[model samples]
Target: MSSISDHPLRYKLANELHARPFPSMKAPCSAAYVAIKQPEDAVSRDRAQDLAHLTALLDRHGAPHPQPGATHYYGQIGKYWLKWEQHTEFVTYTAFSDGVVARPFDPAEFDVFPSDWLENAPGQRMTSILLNIVPRPAEDVAVTGSLDEWFVSESLAASEVLDGAAIMAGDFRIDLNGHLRFAVFAGAQTGARRIGRIVQRLCEIETYKTMSMLGFARVRALQPGLNELDTKLTGLMGTMSDERASAEETLHDLLSISAELETLSARSSFRFGATGAYEALVDQRIAALREERFQGRQQFGEFMMRRYAPAMRTVHSAEARLEAMSSRSIRASNLLRTRVDVERSAQNQTLLESMDKRSDLQLRLQRTVEGLSVVAISYYAVSLVGYLLYPLTQATGMSKGMLTALATVPVVLLVWWLVRRLRKSVE
Candidate 1:
């Protein structure tokens, strides 16, 4: 007996789990990260362009190009290692370096990517970040001092994460260099892989946060239009039961509004779904760190609760409102259509009743005309019979008056029987 064979995709599927491994990096390192996305229709963008752009960057350092149609790549480029990943709606490139830095959060750290290469990127920058990693200071003052000097205190979020393995801080604000800033202080016991994980998680948090906020922007822009449609819908519904407004007209308007609502739903469906997914990612990345309070300062999770949660709530509320309005419009349209059908049915009933009355009168008139014809025919029949029976009077010694009177009864009775028979046959 032969052994069972492996599935066609067994190896490929298994390898996917190891793909895009977290970078192994030590403290005193920095990373430049950027996510690029098309201004519109990003999901359907040409993947070749992303690959080509990555190739351009690799060519500068004489690095080997990734496999054709690859979705992720990790390789050394000159002084930094580059990790590139292509996602559904965007692509991200993170350049990690262990170079010496003259200052904290130095704008020049982002210079790892040539200006020309950045300018010629496949799409617009959705977000860019400069991440600095260093050893945690022994003194508390040094930590706070560095944070105070680099970040705005009002928006700063600082936390000790992973049971004090590291401390992370960021203000979630764009700086003068047009990039977000984040700093991580690794404990002496933190290994390189753990430090890399912290940096990766931070990058994910910021990227997903920025992406989710796009839904909020869409909601803001759509609000005024939604309000106008709501008003129109309310007005139309108010007239649904009004006698003065035509039922058909109301139905037409309701259908128009319903169709528009459907279109809005279709257009927003992807963005809303993506927003929810990104929001979840943002939350997960934060939770993965297991943050705790640091120096009485707000943690990342708390900052998101106060600042970011409301925007997501607004997006959810808008989505629900749109659905509710669409359902209301459909219900109203159905009601109006039913009313129109009922009114038409009533009209048909009235018309049928009128036809029945006219038919009855016509039948009565036909019967009266038939009766008059029978009487006229009988009178002529009696005269003809009298003339014929006059000859009988001459032979039997009877008067013409007696013969005519006798013929009158027989003729009238015969005519009545004949008329009844004819009417039965016709019916």
Candidate 2:
């Protein structure tokens, strides 16, 4: 990283790539696939021409205006943006139409569409929609009526299915076979996904350029350090070159100069070490960046493999896995919520049972207290009655106080026993 700053070339290239997104719309796409395939070709020239033809065709029908310097053209004819790109091998075209948009092919019509425009070069076959065109009609009639007259069904399906424009001038029909594959859905999402991958490759090229500049800069920056050390050694060499006629003084000067030269040499070695260290650091940084780039490449590969492969074979497998996992997660969450609810209900029921037990104990205590009150009141009443009978018995020649006291005692014992019996019966 430090080397990147030290070298002017490396620093400049890094700034250039990181400078902008969509720098020139009229310029060629930055994707490596197109850039590497045809390095000699003028990027802007081919792209502009393609755009011009498409724009003229659209204008003839009074379609939406196209923007200047647009690397890709997207138009809304059938509620989908028809995408076109200038790639390395050949121009890539795709339609971003409705979520389940069909590939452009009319089954009923054959003459209106050109078969040569869609055929492959020689041996290779068109495996994905990127190699084909998607036509969005301006209106429903364009799609269902006159547009149906283009292209024999046996023509395109039988051909290699390579780089072909929409058989109809600009009208296309939904590919019935495309239903099993979701990529048939017309929209920019597919092309955008593919374009995203090309941009990443461009970033890698810039990173490599940065690395090269950093290496050169490290060596260049060390020149000054090495030169300073050389100057000291040169001074020592100059002293030895002098022919002064003195024995002791000359010998002493020679010794001092030799020591200085040794020191300077060590300093030079240190400067060289510093340069090596800086280079090593630059290499490490580049390696780390490369690792990150690798991860991005992996993701890009997975995206392409999912997008361009046999439509139903791979994408369908991934969709199934994803859907199955999602369903399992939802079911597990529901079960967990149900368990929580059941536990809460059981806790409430336990709480109610505890409250009922407490109420029952309260009722029993109240009944016992009521019985004790009755027994006490009855004892007092019986004592009063016995006292009244005491006086009457004395008049009939009996012991009044003793008989009354004894009679009250038996009544009190009877009241206590009756209370105990009633309590046992209730229990």
Candidate 3:
């Protein structure tokens, strides 16, 4: 048999898994990460513009460009290893340098992305972080003391992750420099790949957490409009139950409310769905860290549960409320439509009965007219017969009165018969 031909996408599909490889990094290094998205319709934004932006940055460092339609790019840019990945609603850029700066989480590190270039960016930044990685210090107390000086003691969450391959700490707060900070200390024997994974997870957690919060904002903004619509819908539904209200009018109002609700749902559906996905990813990444408490410090999972879970719950509640309102409006509309249909059916029945009564009256009037018509025709026929039989009376010796009387009976009978025959034919 001839060799089997491979599917066109076979190689591409197989390579997808390894397409965005984790950035391998040793300890004593730092990474700058940023994610950007359009303020509106980010998912459907022009990919070419995004590619152009990336190309512009690469050109600044005289670096090679990515493939025409590539969704990811990894290359050396100046003194840093730059990784760029395009996502459905956003894009992320990470730059990893070989060594840490003298000052921990230095603001200057983010300057690698030039301010002028950022000014002309296709979208606003969703989140940006300065991450520092160092070898695990022998003195745990000294590291803890440093963390206390660097981050707010109350908000800081420090923990050992990846089964103690590394210890990570961050306050999850924006510093004066407008960048979040993260510190990771890898075990001396930890593999570079493990360190890379830890850094990747940190970036993901922050990015996804921020993205998920967007849903919260959307829900909050929708509340006032939702309340207004709810009130209007409730009033309209109340009117439906009122005997005096016109069913047609009630149905019209109900349909209007339903349309508004549908519009709202349409506007927010994508954001809500994306929020759920991002929230799930945030949880998954946190779980993947396999975090453990460090020196009694609150672990990442604990902090998220305490602070983040409530917002997610609020978003869920809002979504549920919206869905319930929509369903209720639809139900009310259906009921109103039924009411209108029944009323119309009853009106039609009454109209048909009235039409039947009119038809009966018209039939009675027609029969009376036909009776009069026969009598009149018979009288005229008798008069004409008397005139024509005046000469015949003299020859047959029959009197005029007798001949006239004789013709009257037959003529009356004949007119009656003709009228009956015509009526039968019409019927």
Tens digits of per-residue lDDT for model 3, 116-188: 9888889999999999999999999878877988899899999999888999999999999889999999999
Count: clashes, candidate 2? 15
Q: What ranges in model 3 sit over 4 Å off?
A: 41-43, 379-395
Per-residue lDDT tens digits for candidate 2, residues 143-181, read: 334322443322211110012211111111224532101
What is the descending TM-score order?
Answer: 3, 1, 2
- The per-residue C-alpha lDDT of model 3 at residue 122 equals 94
- In candidate 3, what residue range of length 10 has the lowest lDDT sum? 38-47
For the record, the alpha-carbon RMSD of candidate 2 to the native fold, in angstroms, is 33.6
Model 3 / residue 139 / CA error / Å = 2.7
Question: Candidate 1 or 3, higher TM-score?
Answer: 3
Q: Against the unseen true structure, what C-alpha lDDT does each candidate score?
A: 0.92, 0.38, 0.92
Query: Top TM-score: which candidate number?
Result: 3
- Candidate 2, run of 10 with poorest lDDT: 26-35
Query: How well is each residue in 1-427 modelled by candidate 1, as lDDT tens digits?
Result: 9999999999989999899899998888899999998777555689999999999999999999999999999999988999999988889999999855678778887887889999998889999999889899899789999999989999999999999999999999999899999999899999999998999899899889989999999999889989999999999999986998899888888899999999999999888999999999999999999999999999999999999999999999999999999999998888899999999999999999999999999999989998998899999999988888998997878899988988999899999899989999999
> Model 1 off-target regions past 4 Å?
41-43, 368-427
